[model samples]
Target: MPESGSVELVWLFGPFAVYLVMLGVYYVWEGKREEQLRQRYEEAEHGQ
Candidate 1:
């Protein structure tokens, strides 16, 4: 059987790692979309 400390460590760190990964992906996706929107707005303003 696994020790309680090891089990607790796994549970704690596992979710944290997953959350960090998800946050990173979200940030990248949001940044790209924002940049695209800004470019489109700029182009529209310039009548391009």
Candidate 2:
């Protein structure tokens, strides 16, 4: 029931929106993982 112009808009921008969300999720996940690794490394280095 939508117009033809709007359909094109969705095709063009929908992937972009999804990509941005995925990029944000990846950034946050990597940040947390890196933090955990850094903490583990520091603990081991200073414990010796």
Candidate 3:
């Protein structure tokens, strides 16, 4: 019974941990993409 309980706990927490990690990665990627877009816009405006 104790072993089964431990396995269940691991199953629940494992996905939660993976989700948090992926969320952090997504946020960083989005921030970098936005920065690149902003720089391109600024360059375009100056070229005009």
Each model's lDDT: 0.98, 1.00, 0.97
lDDT of candidate 3 over 1-48, digit per residue (tens): 579989999999999999999999999999999999999999999999
lDDT of 2 by residue, 1-48 (tens): 999999999999999999999999999999999999999999999999
How do the candidates rank by lDDT, highest first? Answer: 2, 1, 3
| Model 3's TM-score against the true structure | 0.83
Clashing pairs in 3: none
Query: TM per model?
Result: 0.82, 0.94, 0.83
Where is the poorest 10-residue window by lDDT in model 3?
1-10
What residue pairs are clashing in model 1? none
7 Cα displacement, candidate 2 (Å): 0.8
The list of candidate 3 runs beyond 4 A from truth reads none
Q: Which stretches of candidate 2 lie over 4 Å from their true place?
A: none
lDDT of 1 at 37: 100
Steric clashes per prediction: 0, 0, 0
Order the candidates by TM-score, highest first — what do you get? 2, 3, 1
The global Cα lDDT (0 to 1) of model 1 is 0.98
